[model samples]
Target: MPKFLIVGATKFEIQPLLTYFKIPVHSPEGLFSTESGPDISALITGVGMVNTAFALGRYSHNLFDYIINAGVCGAINKDLKIGEIVNVTNDTLSEMGAEDDSEFIKYPDLNLPGTNYYENQVQIISSALNGLRKVSGITVNTVHGNEQSIAKVRRLYEADVETMEGAAFFRGCSRLSENYFQLRAVSNYVEKRDKSKWQMPLAIENLNSFLISLIEELEK
Candidate 1:
């Protein structure tokens, strides 16, 4: 069986899923016991862009066959409410490139030397999430947006949601292997970090259920 590498942004995002898999809580860095999980390996790769990239690059150094970046994100579109899963179709850094005199130097699909550029893996991931309701494919990056920025990203990328780690995960996975996918769930709206409005708990529950089903399917 091909090994699947499950990457979560934090333990909060992965706790429920870990329970479903019967994976014992070993350490903060996610060193799982073979007696706990059968086939899957989970890693809690901190949060945000830089940490996520570093974790991916470090662990994916010919260590794993398949990589799945799963976590909670914020909804950019009002229609996509809380506790919804969003598979990443494509991603771009919201703070990449350069700032010149007046214009931001946006690099378009340029695969520099050995750096892996963006690619679409949504269809494959969505296929796995076929019957799972309230799931979407999103375009995510590091920076959360204001109204104007959200509007611009939605217009340009047609993304249903946004996040901080998807782009970096994509870049890292692309550099490592081709059999990787990104799965995200919405915990709050894009406006602000309102804990009262966040559905993190519910999202984790749904994410856990989703992961269990996916694992069963993979086993079959």
Candidate 2:
């Protein structure tokens, strides 16, 4: 049985899956298995890049055959429907650069050697998860609420969705595990920060349900 790690940004994002699997709640600092018979474990790495990196780093020694980072995200592409889950094959650290006056300069623009983006090479498109679209994403410390900022990011990267911890999760797993994935559900559009328009419940429900199915397939 291959050990699996299921990571989420918050309890709210993964609560449905936990309940559905009947996984008991445990300390967030360590890994715990699900009651349902597979060697699957989960972790809630609080909300941001720093927290995610730290949490993963703290548990870097643990062995996991596959690491799945699951959560809800805001869609940058209007074509993506609410409650739709997608596999993020690539992710960028959108704010890792300097701001010169009104213009933002990226790390690559500075002729930097380090990369600001990470790609998942072991992305598997099993029949159980093939229905979800594969898309690129951008991770930021601050979510896009201003139209001007959103447009700036759009010009910089062809990202389909935006999330707070996706890039960090990717980068961390890139160093720790050979097989990793990011699955995100679109909860709202990236145009403006309007909670009124966000379908959070629907997104969570759909995302968790898909996660449950994916885990079951992976276990087999």
Instruction: Identify the candidate with maximal lDDT.
Output: 2
Cα error, candidate 1, residue 22 (Å) = 2.7
lDDT of 2: 0.88
Q: Model 2: per-residue lDDT, tens digit, 27-79?
A: 55445567667777788888899999998998898889889999999999999
lDDT of 1: 0.67
Model 1 regions lying over 4 Å from their true place: 30-33, 62-65, 100-103, 109-117, 122-128, 131-157
Write down the RMSD of all candidates, one decimal each. Answer: 3.5, 1.6
Off by over 4 Å in 2: 27-30
User: What overall lDDT goes with each candidate model?
Assistant: 0.67, 0.88
Q: Name the lDDT value of residue 25 in candidate 2.
A: 73
Go through the candidates in order and give the clash count of each. 0, 0
Error of 2 at 111 (Å): 1.7
Write down the worst ten-residue block by lDDT for model 2: 27-36
